[model samples]
Target: MSDHLPVLKVRLFGGFSASYGEIPVSFGRNTTTKAMKLLQILLYHGDTGISRDKLLDELYGREELADAANNLRVTAHRLKKIIVDAGLPSHNYINIKKGIYRWDAPMPTEVDAHQFVILSKDVQACTDKVKKLALLKKICLMYSGEFLPELSGDEWVLVESVHYKNIYSESLQELCKLLIERGDYEEALRFCEPACQLYPFDEWQSVRIDCYMALNRYKDAVQEYENTAKLFFEELGIRPSEHMMQQFEQMSSRLNYKPQELGDIKERLKDDDVRGGAFYCSLPSFRDSYRLVSRIIERNGQSVYLMLCSITNGKGMPMDKPDKLEALSGELLNTIQQCLRKGDSFTKYSPSQFLILLVGTNKENCSMIFDRIQRYFSREHKSWKQYLDYFVSSVAEVDRQDSPIQFNTENKTW
Candidate 1:
């Protein structure tokens, strides 16, 4: 054969060597365990030189150094021969220059683990929201299983495996949030499915509940909460958090309860003072609210009304970084909750859209509350200048008895 294609591709994320293409390539006879480990270590290190001492510590840890070094040399030699026989570039797979061993490959090769790290860094640097979302989607597609599913027992492999798993979970959460903001609830639900499988935490489950509620799938939302509640109780012998319980109640209210009782439900919605507002606030769709308001008036029942004001030039703040965003959101919610009375409720309709149900409060009181919110945000800007900006639009009130809940930029008075 005048022209022979390359035979093998070695992936070192989990452990040593193999080709996984249309036609698989195998390393020829007599590859020992130690030899394979040496190859794996080099691939895992990837272009970095591992010091002789470090290598010994990693491979033999507390064992006699003299014996380990001798064994390592023999293994490296055997690996070099295997590399050469496999019809792959083998020149400097392992080099000993001044007592340090380095892998210097002449040609670039594909390694899933290496590619994943590069992609993750790129995703972080992306400024465009849509582009960042797309890059994350691609990165997720690349994950078939854990970094190295076959090397579960290996210590080094386990470390890398956990690292990749965390990245995958974070990326999925970000994607779900993005989809939710775009009003793509179905897609958000799909993303949360696999994420909940991996994390099994209350956060992902909560997100799933939000998506279902957004889609107006009340039954599904209730079922998911029940299932998650059971899982928490059985697995950890604990009750669902107070916040989770409220969400469940709000969701159930939408299905069986009458809108006339909306006045009474407000008290339950009051959130903690430190946080901005109620954790779960349900706002009917614009069209649905129009019909709902009419029904309330026909029945001669009063409705606690809320309106969303657009925030001009308001780009959603970067809350994607796990630790920072979670803390900030918690604080904001607490503040919102503190501002309202026992009977008031608030729901996050969209990333930037919030619906506040001011129970027994008239337009004048709502204006005062709006002014307070403006001041709060203004103060937040001074301290967190780089992070916060004045993006909020005007806040107005909707007359629950006569007018439908809609947004208007023109009328400043309610």
Candidate 2:
């Protein structure tokens, strides 16, 4: 018995990694999920011993098994062997009797997820603002990613993952707020960047934009808003939330506006007033325009149609290859711009698609427009073998009061 050996350290965040003091517990080159999942289940159960039936269900689910009870026995045996080999006391590390298993935690174990929970609780309970800020900062760094992120579809893992993710998001927001209050814009951005990349939550991007605004980088803030809007639409097919839109408005309001001279304004209007091509606008402009058009249609009852176009292979499937998708998207953009009238407005709603608001157009006109654009693209890119798919829906068919844009699943592929 190595009495001087320290407790085992288990890291469940990002992925599962176990070490006893300085020596790592290797599950061998061919690591099996049986032993790893067994350990995860025991850790999750904590002091409460989980029944044999529950463990079998979590591990095997609906899969057919010849002898599940025996399998569980072997898995538990292997897990205990690994623990004992890693220098942990075999006699007390895992407690099993009467078909119930529990991790005894004989040594002072340090699991990242457990530590995160403890630190977060302390941060919440702390009354002193200074102490709370320090605690928040410390706890925020502890969460590298979701709990047991490698295990997906497991009920217990998913539930705990959601719990930890919510804690992480909230902690990040609170930490960013504290840093912003301290006028630490650079440090605030350091927190915001990773948050935005990890998840497409607008609130995280909003914090990053605020950091940019604080540093007097108005252009960067506006650019970030555009990038964030693009990401939301591309990945989720949703517009930016009201909270994000409000942040955009605030950032825009902070910019110094210079009133244009009458002569300069008149000259600019003369050169730019010509309309007859697809008016490419940012995602926010697209949302505002869509709302405005929806209202106008409500009063006048005009035949306004919203069209969505996506790139696909000639076989009528979405193009998944990035290089091919990019090329097709550019070609589609050019085709749509050339084919559509100047009165119409379009936006690159996603990396592989475009959203167009067709004014005073019926189903026949919409089809003709799609056909023309397809024909032009086909003529220009004869070497390409992909198709541009379009879906058209009437403005009246949508519930405009609820959402700015509603995607129509029924689409016509070329």
Give candidate 1's TM-score.
0.53
The per-residue C-alpha lDDT of model 2 at residue 152 equals 43
TM-score of candidate 2 on Cα atoms, chains taken together: 0.59
Q: Which runs in model 1 stand beyond 4 Å of their true positions?
A: 1-22, 25-33, 62-66, 81-92, 104-107, 149-162, 240-242, 257-414
List, residue by residue over 383-408, the lDDT tens digit for candidate 1. Answer: 22233322221123243334445545
- For candidate 2, lDDT tens digit of each residue in 1-414? 344559677888767778878878775543327788888878767777799888998888646899988898888788888767756665655677888888876566667787888889998898887898888877777776667766744545644665777788788888888889999999888877766766653348788887888898988998888798787555433345445565666665676434452234233334243543578988788878988988898899999998988886555787656655665677678667756766799999888889998998898988877766776665422334246777888878765545445755464221
- Please give the CA lDDT of all the candidate structures: 0.58, 0.72
TM-score of each: 0.53, 0.59
Q: What is the lDDT of residue 402 in candidate 2?
A: 58
Superposition error at 371 for model 1 (Å): 51
Q: For residue 209, give model 2's deviation from the true position in Å.
A: 0.9
